[model samples]
Target: EYRLTNPPKPPATVEVMDGENRKHTLQVQVLGAEETWHTPSLLLASVGSSGGKVVFSQIRTLDPTEDVKQYGSTLNRNKICDIAFYQKVHLEVDPGQYESEETKFQALQKSDKARLEILQDLLSSHLGLSVAEKQGPLPAYTPGYFLGRHELKLDFLSALQPRLKADNILKLNLLSLQFCGKGVEPSKPTASLMPVFLHACPQRFSTVEYFENLHSEHIGRLLIFSEVMTSSMEGLDGAVLHHGLAVVACQQISGAGRSGNAWLSPEGCGMFSLQLHIRSDSYLGHHVPFLQHVVSLAVVLAICSQAGHEDVDLHLKWPNDIYVGDCIKVGGLVVKTIVDNTMTVCNIGVGMNLDNNVPTTCINALLRELKLAPLSLEKFLALVFTKLEKLLVTLEKGSSGVDQVRQLYYKYWLHSNCEVTVIGPQGSKQEVTILGIDDFGFLQVLAKDGCAFSVHPDGNSFDMLRGLIAPKVK
Candidate 1:
């Protein structure tokens, strides 16, 4: 090994000459195993011999750590023996070839298979669902199946169903199993059937055909959409079909379509229904509104059924507003009723910002303070619907349905404790401290005089006051 402690002495200066008779001087310093080589304008001299080369020899007997020491020894030996003097000329080479098409294809195939396997695993584990081979031909309408432990229902369908065909089956389509019961209340189990259709293909389909298929049913037949399926149909006179409820939510895959609208019956007695129109890029904006309406109606019906309250006093507020909280604006509810001598259609709409990040004129600024990521529209909708179904079940049993929903809503209140400015009609304004929402979806505010006032949705003015600095207390 090259020892750093002791080294050899220096050598005298040397002269070198090139083929062109060019002359140069060189210096060599040797400190035992530590040798320093210096060339001061040294010319290249052939000297009828090879230039120089350095080679490394491995020490077979030494351990891994000791091998590093051996390397130094080899380097020292080469220096003292002038082994670098026997090197050859240099050469240049080109770059390597690119990856072949077949190789890339195989890699992609492997990656796709891996992803599919992961999906299958997740479905089996969390969703408790299974997949089987297709029994028959295309457009197959498989009976609904129950999800394990969760009691959720799902239906399988080929791309050939009327709705799927009308919508065009550019991908795999699955029908959701929904429940339909007597009247607009989803209390009792009617009949378990598949009504709503879900497309899992790579291509998008038409929304008009989807809604038309949902509205069409044979006489005395009940329609159940995905996740909203019922279990029984006894005592159902098919009149509910005409005067019942319907919710239609559509998201555009392409083309121009970016707005959403919903309608409700005049009172709580008529048919209720919901309708949505989503353009390709604007689905994100309208998704929550559509889902909130559907779920809110479901929850209301569920509550009425359980409480056995034949006289339900409920009315939908426009632009996604719900009525509760001491007559203030606690939440928003919307309903659409289509009634004719022959048929009655009811649709319900509900919308709550839940956890929005964007700032709006009426919405509080607390939403901007939350650092949560934008929620997935599909996943959030599914979860909200599922929870609403459970809450409805509880309410139908004569429990406090409104209280339950209120509690949940309060848990997600962003402006529960804040000072706000309310703009009234004719340029009237008042400052108030929020004391939380009440039972009827209203904004309860404590004025400067310590008195509480309820703010309604349709009043002359209702805007949130913000960006104001508080005065110091003397």
Candidate 2:
């Protein structure tokens, strides 16, 4: 029932309101006479209202296809995706929306008007707005900004330091002090803050600033460095018991990717790893495989929160790639979970192109194309953590939670009813239409002859641009 073949077409009618508060109903119709699975169609209408005649002009808005009517039907799917990308970039400006430079400026001003306010509201509900202040600042260890040692309590640091040192934790200091309520207004709240250790330095964004903006307990410790080896998940095998700990790097010398491909992680990329403790007996633990899906959705929603979703053309490609428009990849997610007795220790790693453009593209570059302001790595991380916290709660709600996430995943993903060339077990190629995810989170595809099969993300390489899904070379 959750699988999708041919999704129902767009609605038949749309209601439009005139300046005088009068409502007019217009019939919606696809532009092209002939429609295919990947056909590009524009829904436009011309109707009269009391104020004036409302004629919906034809514009180059993107649809999920090659526009077979305009271009001949023999184009490949990847070519279609590339064409759609270029068309969307050079879309005709709607006179009503951007008549003049002043009007366009006004529209940009009104965009994301309540984003910060919304973030503050979530912070108040999740982390308390106010709490008792810590007794005093701890001794300054490595001097720069607000000294990292100044935040540590003597008794707690003495104990945690030995354990951290024995574990070979490098370039990180241990702290057991409560989170200082620095950003928000002062108030009296009964709840006291929990104390934990985090990595802070002048090398990147202030560690103190990170916790001040973050409002979730899921990210307990933060470790950020100028560079790291292999991946963020490297040298973290023994840290599973330290739940909610995260490691970040400004640049990765050798970043890992799905199926052992190398991820180009130069400077300006947002790369990090988070360790979480989930109970095996719990609802979320039973669906460990779905963690990748959850993280992927969280990444998309976090960026979408910055500017309105309509302004940005970001979307999820089949398994875990974060694609912009239909061609360029902007970010990705990787999940590694270990079941130790009754505890399922999960490590979620994420790499996003926040401001970097060296590889393919980044989130800010995409925003730039839309004439929007760039997002800071700090703000992006805060939003991502907030979203991940909210989604994890939803995932804990049982079957209904699964259905909600599934619906959202389908909505934000790029491959619905798309036909791709799949290489089977014996290396024979066959074209198949993408249905949806099966119950186990694998991609379910339907063949032309009514034969259905599931494609595992690990075993297959999804080349969306080429419209090819081939077996990964072991």
TM-score of each: 0.29, 0.58
- Residues 189-261 of candidate 2: C-alpha lDDT, one tens digit per residue: 1112112223334565755566665777555333433243345666344444355656565655557777566
Q: In TM-score terms, which candidate is top?
A: 2
lDDT of each: 0.32, 0.62
Off by over 4 Å in 1: 1-334, 337-346, 350-382, 395-401, 459-474
> Global CA lDDT of candidate 2, please?
0.62
In model 1, which range of ten residues has the least summed lDDT?
Answer: 249-258
What's the CA error at residue 16 for candidate 2, in Å? 58
The TM-score between candidate 1 and the true structure equals 0.29
Off by over 4 Å in 2: 1-200, 220-230, 307-309
